[model samples]
Target chain A: MSDNTGTKVKGQSCRLPRKRFYRARAHSNPLSDSHFPIPICPAEFDYSHHYPYFFPSGGEDHKNGSASPRKVRFADIGCGFGGLLVSLSRLFPDTLMLGMELRDKVTEYVKERILALRASNPGQYENISVVRTNSMKYLPNYFGKAQLSKMFFLFPDPHFKEKNHRRRVISLQLLDEYAYALELGGIIYTMTDVEELGDWMRSCLEDHPLFEAVSEEELEADPVVKLLTSATEEGQKVARNGGQTFRAIFRRIKFEEE
Target chain B: MEETAEFVSNAGEDSASVAAVTMDVDNGLIEDDKSKDAEVAPALIAVHPFEKSVAVAVGFELRLFDLEGNCSVSLVDDSGGPSHSDAIRAIKFGANGRLFASAGDDKLVKIWATNPWHCIRTVSAEKRVSAVAISHNGHYVAFADKFGLVWLIGLEGDNAKQSNNDKKAVMILGHYCSIITRLEFSPDDRFIASADRDFKIRVTVFPKQSLKGAHEIQSFCLGHTDFVSCLAFAYPSGCANGYLLSGSGDSTVRLWDFISGVLLATCEVGAKVGSLEPNGTEDAQSPISDLCASSDGSIIAVALQYSNRVALLSCDFSNGNLSVAKVVTLEENYFPTSLGSSSLSKCLWMVMGASNLPMPGSAQLPTRLRIISGLRKDPSDYHCHDPIILEDNEVPGGQKLLSELQGSLDVTKEEAALAAAAAAVKASMRNMMIKKEYTLERREMRKKNRNDRKIK
Candidate 1:
C-alpha cells in the first residue's frame, strides 16, 4: 500500500491506469500517445448481436410507453467470464437479466456472449447486458434503490485474515449496499463453497437489517430452490465434489412500524 | 490518526515485540504472572461449563469452539469425525455440557459426548432437525425439524454405554402446514418455544424424567402475519423477566412476555412490513431481516431490509420506548445473515456472506463471526461538540428507496427529457454567445499589437 501522499499524485488521488483503446475500424491499436492522443470515431449502436429484436415491455407498470419487451429481473454481481449469466439468461427466459463485472476483459467477454446469444435467439435477446464498474461503488448507480428483485453474489473473494476481514464482501457495511439495491421483499441470492464463507453469509444475512432467512423448511419448499440447487454454475461444482452444500435464503423484510 | 495507527502497526513487528514492549512498561515478572494466570483460568473453567461445545454446525461438518479467556477455541477440528451422511442443521449441549447432539437434512440426529469431542449415540427423527435446544440441567434435549415435529429426548444417565443404548426421542407433532424454523429452551428448562412458518409460536412444558410420552403444549403465541423466522430468549444475566425476541416474515421483530404470550413491543426494521409477495398485491412487503436482543434485555439489535443496516435499539420496555440508540450500516454486497451471542460476555458474533469457492461453482463464503462487546458506556463522553443529525429524507425512511426512485425516475421519458434538454441547450448557447461576443469585442482593440509588431 502506498502512502497517502503517494496516493495523491499530481492533482489526482490514486488515479487508475488509463485503459488501452483499440480501433475496430482502423484494425489497429494506438501506437503513439503524443500524435494520436485522442481517437476520432463515430459512436455506433449495434444491438444485433446482443439484442437483435426490440427490448421487452411486459413489466407490470409499463403502461405508459413501449420501450422494449425485455425487462431486467435478475443480475449477477462480479460476473467473471460470463458463463453463469449466459446460462441463467437461457434458464429464466421470462426474466430479463444483467451481469455487472469490474474486470473490463470479463465484462467484454460477457457482452460478446450476450451478443452471440442474441444473434441466435434474436426474439429473446434483450435480457442481458454487462456493466463495467466496481460492484460495491456502482450498485446505487446501476440499480435504483430496491429496484432489483434478485441479486447474485457468486464466488466473491474472501479476505480471510483477521485484519483483512473488512475487505471481505460480507461485512456490515456492504450489506447496506445490497439492501438498497434489492427490492423490498426481493431476494439476494448467494452461494459459496467455503464452510467459513457460507457461515459468514448466513450470519451476515441472518444478522442484516434488510433480510431474514427463509427458514430451512421454507427454503426447501420454495420453487426457487430448484434454481439454487441445479441452475447456478457454482451449485453444480459443489455437487460434483460430493461436497455438502449449505444453502440459506434471506428475504428482504418490510418495516412494520410507520 | 492514520499516521499514528501506521506507526503502531510498524512498531510491533511480531507478538514477541509486543510482549517486550509490555514488559518494558510493567515489571517482567508481573506481566508473566498475568499472562500465566490468563492461560490457566480457561482450562479451570472449561471443566465446569459445557463439556463438548459445537461451534459451527453446517452440513456434515460440526466445528465446536470452546470459550477461553474472552475468546472461543475451536474443539471440533481437534477431535475428528463426528460423522453424518449429510449436513448438520442444529447442535446443542446437554448434560451440563457433557452431552452434545447434532442433526441435519439427512433426517438423522447424531449425539455425542465431550472431554474429547466424540460421537456417543445417534437419535433418529423421522424428519430433518432444523433447530435444537437443551435443558438448563442438561438432562433433556428438545429439537424441531422439517416435518414441524418437536421432539424431547431424555439423557438416561452418565454411563456412556447405557446412555447410548437408551437414547429415544419423544416426538410431538402439532405445527400445521408449515415447517419449523427455530426451537429454543427457556433458561429454567421448563419451557420450550418453537417458531414455524405458519407465524405461530408453540411453547411446550417438559414433563420431568420422561421421554415416554409427548411434550405438553403450554401455549401458542400468535400475532405475526408472516412466517416466524427466528426466536431468541434473552440471556439470563443483567435482567429479570426474560424477554423473548422473535423475527418474522412480516419484517418485524416482536418482544413477547416470555411466558404469558403477550406482545410487549415490536421493532419494525426496514419498510415492506405487512406485505409478503411483491406481485403488486397487498400482501408483498415485510421489513425485518433478523433480530437479536441483548442478554440484559436493554438492547434489541435488528437487521433491517433494503439497506441491510443493523439497528441497535435501546429497549425501554416499561415506557414502551424502543428508541434507535445506534445504527451500524453495512454495504449492499454482503448480507448480514446469522447472529450468535456469547454466553459469558454479551459478545455478539455474526456470519456475513457465504464462502467464496474457486471455479465453476459458487463456494459459500466463510461465516465471519464478529464479537461486538458492549461499547464502554461513559456518560461523560456522550456530550460531543458536533452532533450530526442525518436527514431522514436522504435515505429511505424504512422503505425501499430504490423502488421509490425507480418508480419516479424513468430514464425513458423522452418527451419530458427532450424538452429539458432543449432548454438546457438554449441556456448554454446563450451563455456561449455572450462570452464569444464579449471576447470578439475585446480582441479588436488588442489587434494592433500584432500588426505593428517590431521586426526583432
Candidate 2:
C-alpha cells in the first residue's frame, strides 16, 4: 500500500490513505451536539458544496431551468473508513451517495480518500462524499421527506446495555425517521457480526409496521446484499477473522388499506 | 503477525465476561453519573377550561381538586389495572372539560372523564410516555413516548367497551430519536405541533383519517438553539389563524406562524427573568420549563427552570410581536416546575415540587401551589394594577384546595428543602435535556469499557 503513496499519473499526483493513520474509536455518543454545523433544514443544505460536479457553481443551470436539482439518494450511516462508499461508487456511478461519520479524524480521512480517488481517476468518485455529522440527531436536517432511495447501516456500534438501546443506529423508533426520509420502495440494509445485535436489528425491523422483510429470493437477486459483508472496513475485518455475519434488509412500504 | 495477534486477543477478551472488579472501575465514570440517580420527575399541572377543577401529578400520584364541589375527587377505576406505577410526566385537559389525559414513565396513557374523574380508558404504550395532548374536539388523545414516536387512540367509542379490551393505539408521527417534550394540537385541530429535545418543533397536518398516519408535515419551526421544552397555541381574539408559541432551553420564548413556518417574534426570557449570570456560562442560562397562553391569546406565562419568578409576556397579534410585560416574583424562594391557567379565569396557577426530592431527612415531599390574579385580556389594563398574589383565603377553594393538592399546608418549615429540591430538579433537567460533550480520550475510554462489547 505504501508503494502507491504520492504516485503521479498523467499530470496528477494522488495517493491512497493508509488505514493505520485513520483509526478511530468504534462508538460515538450521538446525544452530544458538539459536532459540525448542521443545516437548519433540508432546503438550507447546500448541494453545490457537497457535490460540485452535479450542481455547478454560479447557478447557471438554476437560472436557465434546464435541469432538475440533483439530490443525494444513498446514505451510509456510520460509514467507517468509507470502504463501502468507495466500493459502491463504481457499481452505481450516476448515483450520489453520502457517508455520515461522527468522528472528526475519520471523516477527514474519508474526505481525503475520496479526493484522492477523484484526482487519480477523474470523472469517477464524483458521486460520493463524506460529512462529519451525528446522523441520529441530524438526519432530517440533511435529507428531506422521501428524499433517499437507500440507506446502509453497516456494522454499527452495538450499544449493548438495555438503557443504551436507544443509542442503537437501527431501532424501531429511528426506523420511523428513516422511513420518512426514504422514498416509497426504498430499502434499508443493516449487517452486524454480533448475533445479539443482529437479532435486535431484525426484530426491530419486523415489529415496525411500515417495514417488511425483503424476501430471500429478492435478497439473493440484489447486488447490494452481497456488498454488505464484503465492502465495508468492519466487514472486511470480520471476514478476515472468519466471523459469521447476519444481515437484515427491509423495504419501506406504505400499508394498503385493509 | 503482531496485528493479527492483537486482533485475536481483542476478540477473546470481548467474548469473555468482564470481571466485577474491572466493571466497578468503569461504572459511574461518565459525566452523567451525578444526575443518573437523581431522576426526580418535575410536577405537572393542568386546569379545566372552566376553572372548576385543577389536577397535579407529582410522582406516581395524581391529585385533583374541584373548585365548585369544594372537595378532592377520588379517581374510580374498575379496570383493576395498576394506576400510574411510575412518575407522571404529562397531564392535560381537553378543550370541552369533559376529558383529562395523564401519562408518564409508567408507559400507560390514562384518559379520564372530568365530572366523575374516572379512568375511562388506559392505553399501553411501547415505551415510557413523555408528553400527552387531547384534540380540541375531544375525539383523540395523543401521547408521545421518550423514544420519539407519537401514538393516537380514538375516544369516540363506548368508554367501558374501550376500557375492557386493550384498545390498540395507531402510530401517527415521530421526531426521530429525540425525546419529545411537549405536544399541542392547534386550536382548530387541523395541525398537531410536537417539540423535541433536538431543538425542533414540527407542525404536522392532522388528517381527517388520522388512522392512516400524519404524513403531511405542515412546516418545521426550527430556530431554537436548544431543546424546546414547551408549546402552546394562541388564537388572537378576532384573528382567523392561531399563532404557535414555544419555549426552549436556550432561554427564549418564540412565536411562530405555524401554517407557514415563519418565526414571528422571539423574546429573550432569560434576560427578562434576570437569571443569566454575568459570566454567561452555559449553565447560567435558565431553561424555560413550562409556558401557557391566556384564552384571549393576549397574555403568556413562562416558567424558567431556576428562577423564582414567572415572566408574563404580552402578544400583539396585529404586528406579530412578543414582549415581556410583567415578572411576578414569589414571596418565598419557590421555583415553579409547571404552570397552568384556565381559559375562563384570569388567574395563573403555579406548582413548585418534584417526584422524589433529595431532601436530607424528609420522607414525604410536599408541593407548593400559588395563584396570581388580574391577568387582563385588554392591553390597556396592563398598568391598572399589578397582578396580586392571592392570599390563601382569597384563592379558589381556599386553604382546603391547597391542603388537598399540596398534601400539607405547613410550608414555612420546608422552605429550605424546597430550594434544594429546585436545584436538584434543575441539575436533573440539565442532564436530561442538555447534550453532554466529551473529550477524545474519554470517548475512547467509554467505547473500550462498553459492557455490550466486553460481555458479548
* Per-residue alpha-carbon lDDT of candidate 1 for residues B1-456, written as tens digits (9 for 90 to 100): 232233234322111121211111221222332321121100000111322232543335444444333233333422233356664555555536666667766677666666566665567777666677777777766777654567776665643235454556775433432357778777776677888654567665554543532323444565675567677777535456676778776767777775656667876654422222312334323334456654466556665322335666667665444555666644323234455443432334443321111112212212323334453244576644221223223321212221121122222332232222222222221221111122344334333223223246
Over B1-456, each residue of candidate 2 has an lDDT whose tens digit, in order, gives 232233235422232121110111223446444543347788878889988899988889899999889998899985555689888999999998999999998999998988877987888898888899999999999999876789998877552255465778888887765689999998788999999988899888788777657765667787898999999998888888888999999999999988877789999998777663223343447899899897567779998887777899988876978999889987646778999988865899999888777765655667888898887646676567778888877888988888878877777677777776677777777766776655688657755755446764
Q: Per-residue lDDT of A11-75 in model 1, one digit per residue for the tens?
A: 54343322133111211111000111111100111223333333222322342245533345676
Off by over 4 Å in 1: A1-258, B1-54, B64-82, B92-100, B112-114, B156-166, B235-240, B272-289, B304-307, B354-365, B375-456
Could you give the C-alpha RMSD of every candidate to the true structure, in order shown? 26.2, 6.6
Worst 10 residues of 2 chain B by lDDT: B15-24
Best by lDDT: 2
Error of 1 at B356 (Å): 11
Using all chains and alpha carbons, the TM-scores for the candidates as numbered come to 0.41, 0.78
Error of 1 at A197 (Å): 52
Best by DockQ: 2
